[model samples]
Structure formats: structure tokens, C-alpha cells
Target: MPPPGQDPRWETMGLVHDYLAAEFPLINKTLSLAKVNTYGLIYEWTGTNSSLKPYILAAHQDVVPVNPETVSTWTHPPYSGFFDGESIWGRGASDDKASLTAIMLTLETLIQKDWTPERTIVLAFGFDEEASGIYGAKYLGKALEETYGRDAFAFIVDEGGGFKDVYETIFATPGVAEKGHADIKLEVTSPGGHSSVPPVHTTIGYLASLITEFEKNPYPVELARDTVPYDNLVCMAAHSRDIPRSLKRAIFRSGHSNAALHRFEKDFVLQDKFYSSLVGTTQAVDIISGGVKSNALPESAFAIINHRINTLSFVNETAARDTQTITSLAESLGLTLKAFGEDVIPESFYATSHCSSQSSSTSSSKGHIELSLAFNHELEPAPRTPTSGKESKPWDFLSGTIKATYYSHRAQGIKTETTATDGDNVDFDPRNVDGNTDTKYYWNLTRHIFRYNHKNAAYGSEIATGVHTVNENIPLDHYLEIIRFFTTLNNECR
Candidate 1:
């Protein structure tokens, strides 16, 4: 696969589409198929009732490229679809191909059975999701909006969260919200000179200090009620028996008492890095560059700090906090500051903030720091899908379908009949995705977007599954279960 912003492997993507067309002839013949931007696919299965809004089942065709260095370490060759009687081992087996194949197989089976839908079903398959979805989903989103108008779809199901065991209880978490994204570039400039005649601090030194300041002050994590993380906690507390008595009590009491919430955050949330990141904005200095030669003093140094903004916050808030973090240190170092194209610490402020005893010659030696958005890709948090009340009928229906699929998969071939009820062991919860998905582009198409694939994530280690790494594989039964889930969902849709 090509890197982000570069032209994708169009020929490679075409082969997958061609295979789909040949493999699922029934679906290809029945549905209205159109190719967007040469690779992105859209297939619409018209329904009997035009009054009801259509819903989308979305997946991506691309998978992260396999590293050649790790080929020898894989249990089977990365590209080889080796089925060891129980699981299929390949590069795209688990991350996304499973979902894509399941959706296609489900539709084909439904078509073979001569079943027509009351509500329309749309399938959106993008070609470059792994590379930030610029080449694929972006154009596809524009085409979809132009054809269907904004918010025309009832709901959209994309690849995301799945069922997993949390504290001994089985919970299915569908990502109803996704965090925002930003990449802030910090660049510092100084007078270049011989290394022997360098000033007290060079451009690289100032950049290091700024980075330290950012790490010193992280975004505070708060456990607010009605939020996705809090809701997940509530479900765990209500059903999971492995949680400690004190923590469980705190989680239950947190709804009504601020003191309990604080205790829970301090005791549980902060103690667990994963939970803390879920509730707070996260920052990481991902890229840095400095001097080219050892003999010369560096004239400039830059670093890009990536941020996954919290759902409750906006991009502007994150930028503001970044500016605030290094302002004092930059001023103390006699450096002028500019952030997001606005003058933060002007020349006058820099002159006044510096020590008066400093000579005029030293004033000319001061450098300037500039902060700006990197790559021009700044996105606000996605709108949270409604999970309750009258507007959440789609969510309710999906939840029921998930429960039914779980019960049926386990009770297959049994003589006894069973019904999915609230008392059943399974719990449905809404969760927030820390990273963005292709659904990021489809936000305008549907407010009821669910990032989910009904796969069980409790089977193996993340590395063993090879989602974006080596030894990628998926259990055969799990893949079949996904097909069953999608089939049941299509038939049960009202």
C-alpha cells in the first residue's frame, strides 16, 4: 500500500473489487453498483419501502502493509491465506478483510434465499483506509452526500469495537463516538554559527525544553456521568464480579456524588493508563529533526506533537493549552512566540520579559519559536450517536440483534429453544474510539453511526491476531459468526 497522500495502488485495489464481483455474482447482479474515484465502491440494495431511510454497512478494502523484515517470524507467510482447520492466517484476516468478506457473503446468501429488504441497505467499501482514508473515503463521502443529501441514512455500521471480556463479564462495546485529531508542529529558529561560538542555548536546546514542559503537564482526566467511558464503567460495575468492592461502590455512587467520582478517578482511572487515556486528551511527540552537520550550530529545530483530543474538548482548546504550556519557558529563554498564525509573544513582550542587564548585542541573539498546525489536518470530535430515547431505535435494534446473534451462535444445533432477554449474561455498552476510522468522513451522512463488527476480541493477543503486524489470523468460527451477525441484522431490520 502507498503512504498517506500518495496515489494508492489502484491496480491492487482493482483486483479485490474484481474478485468481489466474480465471487458474489448474485449481489453484483442485484445491487446498484458504482465506483467512486476509481476504487471506492458503493452498492445500494433498494428496499421495498422508500418511506424508511436507508442504513449503511461499511468496511474498507485496504490493510496495513506487511513488514518484509518480519516475514520469517510469521507462523505462515503474510500473504498466504493458510487455513489450519480452525483459523485463517493472512495479512488482512482479522483487521478488516473479515468484516468485508462477511458483509459480502451475508448479502450474497440473502440474495440467494430470495429475500428482499423493507429498508434499503448500502455497502460502502473504501480502498485506502489504512492511510488516513484521504484517497478513498474522502471522495466517497462527498459522492454519497451529493447523491443522498446530508443525514439521509438511518444508521451506519463500520469496522471498530467488538465484544471482549472485561472483569470476567462479557461486554459488547460499539464505538458510538470517536476522539478528535490534531498534529501541532513546533519549530524554533536561531542564528547559525560555528559550534565553538555557540550561545548558552541553541535552537535544539529550546525545543527540548518546550517538549519537556508539554510532558510535565498532561491533560487532566475527569470521570463525568453520561459519557461513554462512564457508561462503560457503569456496565462493568453492574455485571462484572471481578471488580474490587471499593471500586465498584465508587463507580455506582459516582453518578450522584462528586466526591465518589473524584475517588474513583484517583483510585482507578489514574491507576490504569488505558482508562486515563480514554477519558483525557493524549499527547505524544512523534517526530523531531535538528542540525544536519556536527560542526555547525543548528539554525532551526522542529518537532511534531500529535494529539488525540478528548471528546468533550475542541481543537481550539487543545491548541490554546499547548500555547499556554510553553509560553513561560519560551519567554524566559528570550524567545519570541507565535502560535496558529497569531503573535503570542511579540518582540515588545520579548524585549520587556528579558533581563534589563542584558547587553544590546545579546538582544540580537534571541531566537523565535513558531507553532502551527501540521499537514493541515485538524478535526473536531465526531457527534456522539444517540443511544437512548425515541431517536435511538436503530441502536436498540442493533443491540437486540447482537444479543440474538450471541445466543444463537452458542446454542447452535441444540434442541431446546432460547430467547435473548435482559437477564442474559451479555451486556451492551456504548464506547468511545481513541483513534479515528473511515466513519470520520461519513459523519455528515448519518448521526446514527456505529463503529462495530460483531467479532469476539477475547481470543488471542493483539500481536497474535496480526491486525497491523505479523502472524495475522482469524478463527474460522469467529468469521462465520460475523457473517451470521450481519445476516441476522439485515433480516431483522425494520
Candidate 2:
């Protein structure tokens, strides 16, 4: 990846537009290509049917920056588009460029075939999805809403969930919803002093104690069948060939025995990292800062705690509750706390002891703390995409196409368990995207938003494509499957 300052959004898109203009003139003639927010690209392909709603397929143009110090550790240069007959190695190979390439090629093929759908199709490539996506998807979503009425699309697909062979079952998870997100700022203040004399606790120390409290008390553990994780588990248990009979029974009897289902999920199912994140809100103390001088005692300290709100929460409500929880804890410790940069603390902080904020919290410290809490960069989780019966056309088309493309490997006597990345049986697994995507900004534009790409693999597991990590690569076979999936989607959706 290029340096953050040097790389400009839409540079790649400009090249792509030029290439398409020269090689595929028909595309320019048939589809309207325009840039939104000066960088985000939207290519619209008008269809014959004015009555049918549009569809959108999206991918991001950016990849995470690679550290200069770690460049030498790479077997091949991070930006080198190296193909060793089996896979393509590069920073964005699997993260998003794969989808961008696959989508472009699929659209080109459709143009060559002169096939037009009855419904309109949109290809949206966001510029800053790796960052906050504020200028990219945010502006694009608003523009789309203004141009087309609210809930204008039949379905919108973006990158999030993917296919994986978990527990011997080839599960194709389509991210039906995403976790909300917020970065809460925790700042502690104190009177400064020389190194010679220090108070009983400094700002850092108080922050540390607050952090400890947060660690001691995690969010309450309660998994309902409605949550994406449990729902996905139930789907897997039903579809997989050899799940244990007891587990199958527990899932089947979930209506009668909710306790048994919850126990089974907590004790057995959530052992996987991917499944664990889906169950509840998560918090990580990502950034912290304190004194600049080594000789002087620090007077002030600050920290940013990033929170991923579970499907159960709205971002603002979650942040408010966490802030109040911290205030209560601070009061218990004989310290005063203010929130959102206010001078006077809320009266409710003293009168109420409610803890409806069932969201995860984190903190850090150097000494005794008094501080103000503030939240920024917040977004509530997306509306859940429908996957059941009548309104499941998008789900059916996507899952059915995936099955048709990948299940043939199984029919050819290929064992899915041969390797982690080899599975492609494509069972429908509707799960929440633990991380936010560009689709998060488009929630108002469409009720049917699915965060999915057929070849996406859960990271940290053996099958991962190394997204945002060192030595990122995409297998040629998996890349082909992506093209096939999109091609199938274009043909079948009509």
C-alpha cells in the first residue's frame, strides 16, 4: 500500500475508467459512470423494467497501511502483484481488490453478452472504507437517497461475511446486520507536581483503577435464539451432515428449552473466534496518552476506548450508559466525573443506579482520576436483512448461486476437510457483521443490505486470506469462484 498522505482516493478508479473507456466502449454507452464525494465511484446500469427496484454491489478501494519497519519480513514485497501460478500476492489481493476486479469483469462479460436485467444494477466502490468512510459511503448513500427515494433498492451487497468450513460444515454466512461502533474518550485531570512529591494516586493511577473495574466486570452473557450467532449455529446444525445428536436436539428444541440452547451455544458453539464476537458487545482500549516529560509528574491523561455494540444496542445509548457506569464507579472511588466535556455532572448520576447499558466497556490509567467522557465516530447497527420466506429473493439468489458454483467440488468426491480453505458447500448462515462496512452508511437507502462476498474467510483461522495483515494473498481458484458468484447473481436475480 502507498503512504497514507501520498495515496489519493479515485486514482485507481481513474485508471480503471480510462481502461474501460478504451476497451469496453459499450459500457460507457450503456451505463452512467460518475464519481460521488469526488472519490467514490458509482456505475449505474439501467435495465428495461421501470417498475423493478435497483440492486447494488459494493467494494472498497482502500487497504490498510503496511508498517515500513515490517516490510523486510515479507517473503515478497507487499505491493508486488506476484502470481506464482497458484495465488496472487499483494496488500489488497483478497481484502477488496478481488471483489473490485471480479465485479468489473462480470459486468464486462454481461455487456459482451448483451444481457440486460429487468432490474437496474449499481456498482459502488467506496474510497475510505478502511478509515471511517465518512466522505465515501456516507456522501454516496445520501446522494443515492436524494436521487432515488428511500428504500429504493431491492438489495445491496457489500463486503463483510464469507464462506468457511467450520466444524466440517461449509457455512456461507451473509452478514445480515452489523455491530454498531463508537470511540469513547476518557480523559482524567489532576494537579501537576514535580517527581519528588506525588499524590496518593495520579490521573494515570485512577484511570488504571477504572480500567481494572471494567476488566473485572464483563457484559452479561445472554444469547437468545434471535441473535445472529445462535441463529447461524442453528442453521449449521440443521444443514451439516454429522453434528452431534444432542447438539442437534438442543438446537431443534430451542423453542421449548431456551436454557439448553444458550448453554450449548456458550459452552460449545462460541468457542470459535468468529462466533464469539457475534454474541455480545466488545470493547478494546486501543489508544492512550499521558505526560510528555520524564522528570515531571503527569497531571493529565487520556485514552480512547473503541466499542463494538452488539445488535441489541443503538450507538448513542450504549455510549451514554457506559459513560454513566464510569461515573458511578468514579463516585464509588470518591472521585468526581463529568461527561461530554460538561462542568456539572448529571443529577441522574447520583440518584439512579440503573445499569441498562449492557454494553462492553474499557479504560486505562496512570493515577487517581477525575475526567470527562466523550464519544465520537458513532454509528448504530444496520437494519437486519430479511432472510426468511417471502422476502428472501436476494438471500436465495446469492446462496443458491454459491451452492451451484462450489458444491460441485463436493460432488466430484473432493473432501471439504482436506484443508481449511477448500470448503465451498455454501449453506445459508445469516450472521451479524462484527465490524462495520461501507454498507453501514447505506442503511437508510435500502432495507435489504447483505454484507457478503462469497470467498471471504474468517481471519486468524487457517483459511484466512490475510486481510489487513502481512503477506496478503488470494488463491486463483477462490478468485474464480468470486467471478462465478457475481455472474450467477447477475443472471439469476432477474
**Residue-level lDDT tens digits of model 2 in 351-463:** 44332332223222222343333444687877788888798777777778777766544355533332334533457788888788898888878878888777745222344
Winning candidate number (TM-score): 1
Model 2, total clashes: 14
Candidate 1, residues 382-440, lDDT tens digits: the string is 99999999899989988999888888887785321222445547788799999888999
Please state every model's RMSD to the true fold in angstroms. 3.0, 6.4
lDDT of 1: 0.87
Off by over 4 Å in 1: 1-8, 359-362, 413-424, 459-463
Candidate 2 regions with alpha-carbon error over 4 angstroms: 1-26, 269-274, 341-375, 408-425, 456-464
